[model samples]
Target chain A: MDRPVSEAQTKADLGETVLFKGAALKLDCGAALEDIEIAFRTYGQLNAEKTNAILICHALTMDQHAASENPLSGKPGWWIDLIGAGKIIDTDRYFVICSNVIGGCAGSTGPQSLKPDGSGPYGTDFPVLTIADMVRAQGLLIDHFGIDSLFCVLGGSMGGMQALEWAATHPERVFSAVPIAASTRHSSQNIAFHEVGRQAIIADPHFQGGRYYDGDERPRKGLGVARMAAHITYLSETTLQQKFGRNLQDREAVSYGFDADFQIESYLRHQGMTFVERFDANSYLYITRAMDYFDLAADHGGNLAAAFEGTKTRFCVMSFTSDWLFPTSESVQTVRALNAAGANVSFVEIESDKGHDAFLLDEPEMHATLDGFLKSAAQARGLNATKEAKDD
Target chain B: MIDPKASAHGNLASSRIDLQLIANRVEPGTKVLDIGCGNGALLDLLVSDRQVDARGLELSQKGVNACVTRGLSVVQGNADTDLSYYPDNGFDTVILSQTLQATQKPLEVLSEMARIGERLIVSIPNFGHWRVRLDLLLKGRMPITGSLAASWYETANIHLCTLRDFTDLVDQIGLQVESCITLSNGRAREISGKPSARHNLLAQQGVFVLSRG
Candidate 1:
C-alpha cells in the first residue's frame, strides 16, 4: 500500500522533507515501515511535458544537496564541479532530482531519528535496509511528482549501485543509466573494509551498543578512526604519494612518536576529523552493511545478464584506471553482462592517477561523455530540448 | 551519405579512404562491430546510413570519449584482450579497419574475430606496394609515404604485410574470401580470382570480404 506526499517541511540548506503519512514501505528484508520521510532537493523546473527529469543518486556519506552548500559543512556540494547552470549535467537543460537515502542522516529518517515509542534513537534497532529498499523509497518520491519516467539515472560508488538497481528493478522507468566507479556485487575485500569500520564504531566506549545519538557523549574517536581507514580506500597509492609523500606535517622533522609526523597521516587526520562533525556513526554502520549485502546478480538467480535481459535502457559504465576499490575490470564485467543480455551499452575507462575518488573530481572527459549520452538519450525520449532542435 | 551533419571532419559522409571502402560493402540492418574504431567515424556512418546496429571497441581513452560524444556505442578496450568476452556469432559483420597488424597476436585475433562474426571485413595497408619497395631499394631505409605515413620507429603497424602474405594467412586459417577490392588511395578496382603477384606491387591498400568456407 502507498500514500501521497504531505506538506513539505523545508530545511535551511537541504531541500524539503516530505512525509508519507501512514504510508507503509515494504523492504527487501521482509520488514515494513510506516510513516516514512524522505529529504530531497530539485534543480531546474520540470517541463510541461515532464520528460526532462534526471535523478542523481548520492554515494555513501553524501546527501541530497548535490550542487548546493551543505548546512552542516557550509561547503559546496560534492558534485559542484560537474553540475550547475551550464555544467555537464546542465541545470539549464534538465530538471535534476537528488535525495538522501533512507539510511542517510541529513534530514532523512535514519538511525539518528527518535523512536516512535519516544524511547530513544533507533540506533542498531533501525531495521536493516538494502539498496533495493532505498530504490523502492525513492520510487515513491518520483511518484509524488506525477512523473512517469526519468530521463536518466546516474551516480558513482554506492550511488552507482543505486543507479544500477534503479535500472534493473524499474527498467521501464529509466531511459538511461551511467554507473561509475561501482560493481555488481561488493567483493569480500570491500566487505572486510566495512567490517573494520563497523568494528571501530561498535568498539568505541561511548557507543553503548549504537545508542550514542542522544547521549551527552558520542563515539567521536571511533568514528574518526573508521573514517580515516575508509578514506584510505577512496585514494590510490599513487595519489597519496603525489599529494603528500614522505614530507613531514607542516614541520621540519619527524616527531618520532605517536603524533602524526608524515603529511599523509596529517591529511587523513583532517579528513576523519571533518567527517565526523557531519555524519552519524550509526548511519555509517547501516549504509555500509547495506552495501555489503548488495549483490544484484545473486538476487536474480546468479545471472547478471538475466537481470537486464531485453532491457531498453541505454547504459554507459565509467571507471578510473587507478580505482582499486571498484576497478575497471568490474565495470568491464558489467559491460560484458549487458552485452550478453543484448542491452544497449557503452563503457569508458578514464585514465587517472586518482583512485575511486576520481568520480567526484573535475574530469573534463567525464563531463563531455555524460553530456553526449544525456543529449542523445533526451533525443530518443522525445524531451523538449530535442523537440525544439528538431523543429529548428 | 549519412548524417549530413557529420561529427568527423565536417563532412556529410566519412572521407577516410579505408572507411569509405568498408562502409559500402556492409548491408543495411545488420549488426556490426568495429575494432579499433578510432573516433567511431565509420561506425557513426554505418549507424546513420546503412541503419546498422553499430558497436565499437577502441584502445585510446580520448578516442572513446570522441566516439561517445558523437553518441556512438563504443567501449575502451584493447582488441587483443577484450575480444575473448564476446559471444560466438554475436555480430553479422566484424570489421578490423587497419588495426589487425597492431594486435599482439594477429592470427589469434583473426581466429577470435572469425569465431564471433558471420562475415569479417578487413582493410589493410599493403607493405609490398611498388612505392614501399622502390623506397627501400633507393633510400635503403624504411618507407614513409601517404599510405604508411608514420616513421617506422613510431608507427603502430608492427606486423605490416603485403596483400599476398595476408591471403596466404587467410587460407591457412581456412576461410574463403568472398571478394577482394584492391585500392590505390580511395578508388577501388577488382583483383584477380586468385592471389597474384601483381596485387602485391600495384595495390596500396586492400579490403577483403570473407566467411568460413
Candidate 2:
C-alpha cells in the first residue's frame, strides 16, 4: 500500500473537513473537563447515506492513527496490514474511522491534558474514569461526524472493550460489532496484574504521587518495570518458549549475575524501555484503573444478557488460542451469555501462537476470516462490488 | 450467467461446489444449515440458485461474516460446543463438509448434528484407505499432506478415523446411513474393497449422507 502523500496533502485531498471535537463529559468523581479535544483520522469517502462508516477502537497503548504514521514514534500505525487498501478491513470499501479515546494521553483529553481549573496538568488530581466514559466520549465524536449509526464497530483488547460498550449501550446505533481478544468482565488475575503495574509506578520516588511532569526526572524506571510486567501477560507460555525458550542473550552460558542473561529477559527489557519513550506514567495509572473497573454484568442489574437485551445488532466475538490474558474460555463465556440473551452472535477461536497480540499481527487465518465476514456484511447491506464507489 | 456482482471481492477458491450432487439431495427452498461452511459456497449457491432458506453455523468468524456479506443468514459458533444450543430438528439438512475431523469430540458432535437436523452430511479423510495404512506402516510416523496439514504435535484432527470406523460409530449410535459416497480427491470410488493398506492414501477422502435411524 502506498503512503498517503503527506498529512497536510492528504487532508487537502480529502476535499472536505471532518472535525472531531466536543465538550467534556462530567465524571462521577465530581470533576468536569471543558472544551475536550479528540484526534481521529478517516479513510475512504462516506456515501450520501453515510451508513458505510466503521469505527475502530485502539488498544491500551495505541492512539487514533489506525493506519497512519505516528507523529510521536515516527512509525506506521500498529494495524496497517489489517486496515489498508484491499486488506481485510478494505478501507477502499468502508469509511473507516479511528480515534484516540477519552482518558488517553495520545491527543485525547486525559490526565496529561490541561485541567479545567487552569492548571498545567490534572496528573493524580484527574477524576477517575471508566470504560463507559470512554464509550460515551466516542459517542459524542460519532455524533459530531453527523453519523447516526455505524456500519460496524470493530476493535481488539481495550479497543474491543470499547466496541462491546458501544454495542451494549447504543445497540440501536451500531449495526454490527466485532470484539476481538476481549472479555465482558475483568478477571481477578487481570486485576492482580494491573495492581502490580500500578505499584511499580507508584514505588518510584520520581513518580512524586503521579505529579511527575515538572522535571525531566520522570518515573522512567518504575514505568518501565510496569511495562515489562504487563508485557509478560500479553504472551502465552508456548509463544514464549517458541520465541525465547531460556536461550541466553548474546552469550552461550549464564553469567550468574543480574544482567539480562536469558533471551526473554532481554526481550522484555527492550519492550519496557521502548514503551516509556512514548507513554506517560500517569496515563498508565488511569487506563489500567479503567480496565480493572470494567464489568458489564455488574452495571446491568447483574444480568449479562440484560446488558444486550432486545438489540438487533449482529455480533462476532473472536479469541486467540494461546491468549491467556483474555483466553478462548472467556470468549466462550461471552458467547454463552449472548446465546442466553438470544442475540444473533458468532464466535471463533483462531489457532495462533501469538497470544493476546494475535489481533495485531499478520495471522492468515484471522485475515481470511475477517475478510470473508466484512465482505458478506457489505453485500447484505446491498453494497455490491459494482455498486461500491471507487477511490480515485 | 454467473453475475460478477454476486461474487464478492476475492476469489473464493476454497469453496468450489459440486452443484449437481448438492441439488440432487437438497430441494429448492428447503431449510439448510451448513456446518463448517467454508467461504459459504454451498449456502451461496443454494440461496442464489435454489432460493433456499439457508442458515449457516460456521466456526470461523471470517467464514460466517463472508456468508453474512453475501446476504446469507449465518451465525458464528463452534459445532463442537455450540451445536447443543439449537432446537431439535431445526433444519431439513445439516451439511458438515470436510470439517468433522478437526472437531474435538467427533462422535458427540456428529450425534448433536443429527439431533439438530433431520439429516446430516459428513465428509472425512478416509484413514482406512490403503495409502494411509501403507504410509503408517512404511514411514512409521503420522502423515502430513495438503488435506491433513499438521504435525503430530499440532494436528487439529485429534479424533481421526477411517470410513469403517465412521460406519461403526453411526451403527453404534443408532444413526442410519441414508446415502454414502466415496471419493478419491473429488472423484467417486467404491466404498467396499480388499483391505489395501495403500487405500488410505489413495482413497484421499470420502463423503457420506447420513440420517437418524
Candidate 3:
C-alpha cells in the first residue's frame, strides 16, 4: 500500500524526485556501475499508459534540475525558460524528466562520492566514462521507473550529445529526438579546446596532481582560466562585437592595462570565477576528457549515417547562427547523415546573437519551432487530444 | 488603380501591404497567390473582404502554420524552388510583398510567378534609394537598418537589385509593367518625374504590376 503523502510530499508529488537505487549500468567498455544512484525529478503527471514522458538531457556542468530550483545553487533551473509552465517543453502537457549524468559533480553520485574502500574520493579512480556509458545509466533509471519508452529525448550542447546517443543506442525507446547546437562526433577543434582546458588545469601549481581536495586550496585559478578560454569559443565574433564591441568596463575610457578593460573580458572573467565555486576541477577534467573521446562515427566504421541505420525515431536538429562552436553547418551535417540513413529529420537554424547559449536563452523562433515540433510529435504518437493512430 | 485603404488581417503591423492597392487590382473571386507571405495577413484580408480564392507560399513553417490555423489555404514552400511546382496559369494574380529582395533567384522566381499567374505584383526594397546609396558610399559597407536586419554573410538575399535592375529584368523577360507604385515607409509617393536612381532610394521601396508583353 502507498504511504500517506505529506504536504511537502504532495508538492513533491506534483513534481516528484523519483529514485532508482542499485540500478545496474553496463557500459560499452565492459565496466559496470553497480548500485547506481539516479536522482531525477518528473514534472506533470505521467499519463495512465506512461507514454508522455520526455527526457531532457543537461549539458556539461549542468544537473538534473531543469525547471525546478537547483538544490546546489538555490537558483532557478538553467532551462526554466524553456521547460516550465506554458513554456516550449510545456510541463502542463507533457511529463518531463531531467537527470544528472553518472559522472556529474551534482547531487548525483560522481568521482567526489565516497568509494567502497572508504578511502575518500574516487578521483582518478572513477572508471573512464563515455557518452554511451551515461546513456546506459539513464536507461537503467528509466527501466526502474517502469517507463518502457520515452516520447522524446531533447537537449543542447553536451546534452544534445546524450540525445543523439539515446537515439543511436535505443532508437525504439525514443519516439523523437531534438538535438540542438551539437555535433555527432568530437571534432579535432573540439578535442583541441578540451586539451587546452585540461592542460590549463594540470599546469596549475595548486592542482597538485588532482589531489588538491585534501589541501586547503583548490585549482580555482586554473579552472577559471579554462572556463574563460572555453567560454570564448561558445560565442561568435559577430555576437561578441554586437554584445561588447570593445566597450570599456565600468569607466568610459579604456584602462589600456591587463585589468580586463573590455566588457567581454570582464564578462568572461565573471563566467570563469562563477563556474569554479559550483564545479569540481577533477570532474571538469573527466567530463572534458569524455567529450574529447566522444566519436559516434568512429565506432560505426567512419560512416556517421550508419550509426542510425534502420532507426524509426524522428529527429529535429537545430543550430544557432551565432554559435560558432557548433555552427549551423554541423547541424546540417547531422541532418544530412540522418537523411542518408532514411530517417525522418527536420532542421532549423535560428537567427540569434546569443551564440551557442541561444538554446538556453530567450529565442522566440526556437521556442516556436520546438513547441510546434513537440506538439506534432505528441499528436503523431497518439498522446494528445489530436491523437490520430498512425505509424510514424 | 490603387486602393489607399486596404489593410491586412491579424498582426497588421507585421505586413507591408496596402489593402486598397490589392483590392483595386484584384477583383472579387480572383485566384491569388502570395509569395513569402508573412502571417497570411494579406491573404486573410483578400479572402474575407474580397472573396478572393487566395493561396500562399511562405518559407517560414510558423507563418504557414499560422495561415493554416486561420483556415487560410497555405503551403510551406520556399520562393527559391517551390514556385516551380505549381502549374502554369494556376493563379490569376501572384503577389510578392517586400520579400523579393530576400530570395536567392529573384529574376527566375519572378519569371516563374508571372508564368503561373496572368499578372504579378512585385514589391522590392530599392537599393538605389538615397539612404542606402549614401550608406554604401559613406560607410563603405552594407547597411544594417530596420529594413535590412542581417549581415552580408548571413543575408539570404544573394541577388540584391535596384528598381532599374527590376525594370530592366521585366523588359528582358518580355513582361510589361502595367502599373507602378512608389512608397516611403507606408505612404505612397508620385514617381512621374522622379529620377529612378536617386528618387528610388529616397522612396525606399517600390511595387510594379506586370503582365506578359
With a 3 Å backbone cut-off (N, CA, C), the pairs that clash in candidate 3 are B3-B20, B3-B21, B6-B19, B6-B20, B129-B201, B130-B201, B130-B202
The interface RMSD for candidate 2 is: 4.4
Instruction: Report DockQ per prediction, comma-separated.
Output: 0.51, 0.16, 0.03
Top-down DockQ ranking: 1, 2, 3
Residues A1-392 of candidate 2 have per-residue lDDT tens digits of 11111112123321222233334466645565566666677777677788888999998888877887877678887889988777777776778888787777777778887776687888998878888888877776677667899989999999888888899989989988889999988899999999999999999999999887877888988889999999998888888999999899999899989999999999999998999998889989988998889989998988887888776777778889889999988887777676556566666678888889899999876676676567666766666453345476
Model 3, range A1-392, lDDT digits (tens) per residue?
Answer: 12212111212312333334434456666666555555677777678898888999998888888888876568888888888666778776788988878777775656776665688877767777888888877776676557888999999999899899999989989999989999888788888888888788889998888777677898899999899989888877887898899798998887767998889989999999999998988888888877777788887899888889888887877888888788877776776677456565556677788898788888887777777678757766887752343467
Question: What lDDT score belongs to each candidate, Candidate 1 first?
Answer: 0.84, 0.75, 0.75
For each candidate, give its TM-score against the true structure: 0.89, 0.71, 0.64
Residue B66 local lDDT, model 2: 65
Off by over 4 Å in 1: A1-13, A116-119, A250-252, A384-392, B1-15, B131-145, B149-155, B168-176, B190-197
Assess candidate 1 and give its lDDT: 0.84
Tens digits of lDDT, candidate 1, A63-169: 99899888778888889887777777778678899999998898888898776778877898898999999998899889888788898899999999999999999
lDDT of 2 at A390: 47
DockQ winner between 1 and 2, please give it.
1
Model 2 TM-score on a 0 to 1 scale: 0.71
